[model samples]
Target: MRQAARSYSVQLAIIGSGMAGFAASVFALDRGIKTAQVGNTGAVAYTTGYLDLLGGDQHSLLTDPWRALVELRQHEPRHPLARIGEQEIRTALARFTHAVSEMGIAYTSPGETNLMALSPAGTLKPTCSVPRTMLPGIEAMTQGAPTLIVDFDGLKGFSAAELVANLRDSWPELRAARIAFPDLPPGQVYPEVMARALEVSTNRDRVAELIRPLIGNAGAVGVPAVLGMHNPDRVQQALQQLLGVPLFEIPTIPPAVPGIRLREMFEQCFPERGLTLVPQQKVTRIDLTDAKLRLSLRDSYGEVEILAQAAVLATGRFLSGGLFAGRNGIRETLLDIPVTQPAARSEWYRERYFDRRGHPLNRAGIEVDDHFRPLDAAGRRLDPRLFAAGILLAHQDWTRQRCGAGVAIASAYQAVKGAVEVIGQGSAATRG
Candidate 1:
């Protein structure tokens, strides 16, 4: 493949293909600024795609997401200022829904929280909301007290009977059973499973068909994590028309395709506007100068260099490689920026492997300013022109709070907006 120009005049270089990268590209492009997007793994592979505003109860974080940050800030002082509040979180969710919808992806709110849904493996997934496409209109059925757990045959990674037994331990009085469907793979790799399902089946309709028998028997219909097909609108219509019960989705296994699909939509939309997409290209070095910022990227084709007036580092956490770890422990990838975490890696976790309480891995992330710029050990900004977004610049635990997507959106927006201002001011200086 032909290499990208060795040196080009670009206004901004947004790294990572996740929400933060896509959001930054869109923001920069909207300002008529030239930008390039490069990253290793695309964010979609690990994202749930739903418009996550505040994870869990809005009221939980509303009173203070900053509480954790406030304490950490005194120690790290460089940690990014979290702009999320109860009301701001609400507005951000609304804005996210509108933005993605305008991109032609339809979504609706489930209006409930801490609900349960089914995974393809016939297991229970306690996802955040009803989700636009999957949740059922089962409230009426539940009045009769029918609780249905939807299932898919041949799905790996979970057991339906185990799920029911677990749920029964909690709500013994609610009537619930597993309903199976066809067409899912008996054994397949995660991505292949996702690609096949996206191509051949309608998860929504299959879920509806399975729950149809229990329509009146159960007041609510729960589906495997694969409840909705890739199409949100179709999933919604199917659930609405099928069982007259409420529907919910759950997290089942690793490499969730539903999450991947959502990420794909954002990635595809970015290039349509002329945003340069460099997949699997990892940035090896970053040198910031008074005049511009320079990046050296390494890929299979070898080293490809790029320079920009400003940059957005959205490469994500250790799992994504945006943050690096070794005997020295975890540190930010690009600048070796200091990270806030337990001095000993052992301090990073609770005694229980799955404590559900905050994990050290979640806390081990970069510290940034209110505008999302990384800071140095001295408590000063690393680069005035540099900005960090997404999980790379961290504060809260996304998985526990269920605000992974929310953090991605809020920080990505803040980074892009800040980049535009700095780039615009620099451009005017050069023209002068």
Candidate 2:
């Protein structure tokens, strides 16, 4: 049987809970806007905990992302990052990372140059911000310091040997070690489980004892991101104290510890700060009226609805189920908004898999105007009160260019700014 629908009213409603949606909420909160955010479990868990701004260009990895943005603006004006001034992007990143740190997880503030962060595959990627637990690894790698990359007996995906082998040419002092996690059967292990276990002091002591003998003369120890889930910095500090060595984390596979920390932190923190957060829930229906927007969805409890003066759509690309690739063509799942895509599906991909330009299908998304409002077929705003953000905006491939976080954060800041303006006007009109 269907349950009674519960409704919420707010000045701004954010759809999608990925990096962009989260960033929009942060911006709105900073502006003192009453906000509600709704989204399904999206791509937040797939991240490496490294916040990437402009990390790469067509063929080369970028160290100075600020300069990369200059080139991007000249070459790709339609790109989401290019649409916003670099100062706004910087401010957005700074505010978002600061908020996350305040929530419990410590992250490095965004800086001028991209940090060479370690990936699960042992390859280095350029990223703007990293968790404090992972920062020492970057320093260790940069100095070619004697560092032991450790892996658990049962942990899969992240291999110390693989990391050592791939990085040996560049960092001759790198070494690999294996240890057994305390009180776990020697079967397949997971990062989340280890992270939670480390939160307990006894487990931290045992694990540190096991890794201490293996450290030898290594200046630092790198482990898969299995530090305490809630307070990773504290956990790393505790473990480092026990081992008497600087400790760092290498990113594990998808749904890793760092990503999980962000998800859990936001889910716990946002509501405390007065933002209505519907975690792991999708907006099933959206009804736009002249006065307000109505959003409907179902949670485990029952039916839920949100009515807001303005809405920001940060629903991500195909992965998050925001943009769907149909047999006929691509589509914006909610509202049937027109998606800017290739004329034919046949042109979606190139003949070669390793095409330098990337697939045309990746660029498929909804078009937005300067205000970040979604446009119709004639390039007119679909709704004065509706705004769009994140990778869902058309033009420029994020994966190939490595600007996912940059586009998401910067566009979200603009979207929230637009929403604030529209909501203020609406309120003033009602008063008049």
Candidate 3:
């Protein structure tokens, strides 16, 4: 392959490509800001397509997530969501879901109450919004509608029988079956491969034909999230038409179809929308000065440099390599930004792994101010041009609280807003 330009310039540079990083870029694009996003689409492919906003805590599930946010702010004032206004949080999440739906893979808009969707393990997930392809599942489970759930012959980790056995008490009408994936050489079947195959019309036809005979008097069909990778909503529509029933998807194992669809969507859509995207690449280092921000990274061809007026650090937690937990303590990976963690390693966890209160180590992350700017020991912003977002901001555990997507999307909005302000002030100084 040939080499491209070694240097580029933009008004804003986003440091990660997880939900937060991608959300920042989307927010920037909406404002017509020239933006460049560089990093792996991190931790995103490990998610279900559902967008959650404070689903619940460790003890109880919250039906009214908005009301729960009010309580959350009072108790956890330093939480990232607490730092943001409720209206802003609502608008930011709504705008993000709308943007992605327009791009592809339609998502239901965030609403007042959390929607109950089924997990691969047959547990109910209380999320704010879910993909339209999976929305039928909520209705099917709630109404006890006769739904036939199918698992593949070779696909592992998702067992239709197990799902039915677990949910039988609440949903007695649920039935389980299995079918062979059509037209492929397969030792082990993967959701990603099955999804891409379904993208072909013939494959959809075959799948629907196979599923139709099994759906005796059933009103709906649920399958492992093996809907078409690129066009899931349309694929669901076509298959439902063929089977004469409402069709929906249940989330599969991690690195499953839902996350894969999103990762591919960002890679394909970002560049088309005039956002400079270096997909699947990470920034080696970032130099933030009083004057400007410089990001350096290397790709397959060669090294590349990016200069921008402002940057958003949304690289995520240890799973994404944004924070490193050393034997001594946890350290921020990219900028060496201070992490607000327990003083000693011994304080990291509790005696019980399933402790309802959760572990302190889960809350370890950087601290940020009202404007989403990371702060120093003195509670001062690290730099006028730097901001942080997502799970990397301290105070609450995303997994336990069920606010991962909310924190990522809302904080990205505030971070991008701060960056825009910084960039605009710089432009004003040039005019002056």
Candidate 4:
């Protein structure tokens, strides 16, 4: 028998597994390009699951994310979001959100105005779109309808009382309750386990039984987002029908159900749809000198290789090992690409911790050209076949601007668009 094949060829290679990397693969697949995605899949789980556009500035929140995008272009033209036209951004976000929905998790479409969504702690956050399971909470809070927010006894990080305490002023009818998780171990229960357990109908039934009695006169009942890891929509619907009221999920905390659902959904669905998903492994080396770019990394079995016509570098920021910070300065981890950062490490941050300008270090990353190709030190394209996306691109601090997911999806779209152009015709011909 032949040994397991260790090498594959594709039209596009995506170099990260975070939102941007995943978005690139989705867009490529939509374009009918053969694609492969490889990266460590941890950071996606740490996200709060709110897809923010230009939700706010350092000082205050913005009602109109599109309007914010317009102003962003005027001031920060180099910002990744600002560089892409609004319509393109809109289309890209809608496509990404729709693709994700089709994969499994249902999401509200991006709208004209940002929705004021709920945070784990009772504070409201302006976001472009939210998971379907969490939409009812936004609706309940906006209407000031009587609602009961419940938490499990041993669950950590999410507190029903904390959410209500902070939100009571705005939504006085909002109340809080805590109950023991049915059949859970005695101590330190996690949201992941709870969510997975909820995949079973009996488990959902046990939860609904406990929540129904406490939801008296409430228009909706909200619970921690442990509504089934695989099919949250089904689990949520079942709970709602059983409770006789609208049901919603509140974001628990980072590394909680919302983000886990996205990562898991990709793992489950991407392979079946003709996408090569290399989960939880780093691409050790990339060779771009050849016409067909080559990427290599080792798995438990042995060395694995991918040959692609074009590649997108969406390896996120420092946390995900996309950028490395050292004694000299920060550098792109994968290709050692030019990093646009402060002159010295001393200037990385402001003298004060909360300076409105944010840290200069946050703005540092590989700069990309109009087509999203990584630019060299003299601002020339590093290689026509290589492009960059996600937080690793320079000139904007995504965290403070509230455009992380927006940047990821939009840049991935543009990068993949550029890659498709390159794939259809040689980069030299496209340039010519």
User: In candidate 4, which residue ranges exceed 4 Å CA deviation?
Assistant: 1-5, 427-432
- Summed backbone clashes in each candidate are 19, 0, 0, 0
lDDT by residue (tens digit), candidate 1, 120-199: 43333344333454444223222335465544555566455555666564445344455444554454424335334533
Q: Supply the global lDDT for candidate 4.
A: 0.89
TM-score of 1: 0.76
Error of 4 at 200 (Å): 0.7
- Candidate 4, residues 371-407: lDDT per residue as tens digits? 9999989999999989999999888887788788999
Best first by lDDT, ranked: 2, 3, 4, 1
lDDT, candidate 1, at 68? 42
Candidate 3 CA-lDDT value: 0.91
Write candidate 2's Cα lDDT for 220-272 as tens digits: 99999999899999999999999998999999989888888888888888899
Give lDDT tens digits, candidate 3, residues 1-432: 766649988999999989999899899999999999988857899998888899878779889988998998899888888888999999999999999999997999998899988999999888998989999989988889999999998888999999999999999999999999997665678999899898888999998889999999789999999989999999999888899889999999898789889878988998999999987899989887647799999988798989999999998999999999999999999988889999899999999998988899999999888889988878889898999989999997998888999999999999999999999998999799
Off by over 4 Å in 2: 1-4
Best by lDDT: 2
TM-score of candidate 3 on Cα atoms, chains taken together: 0.98
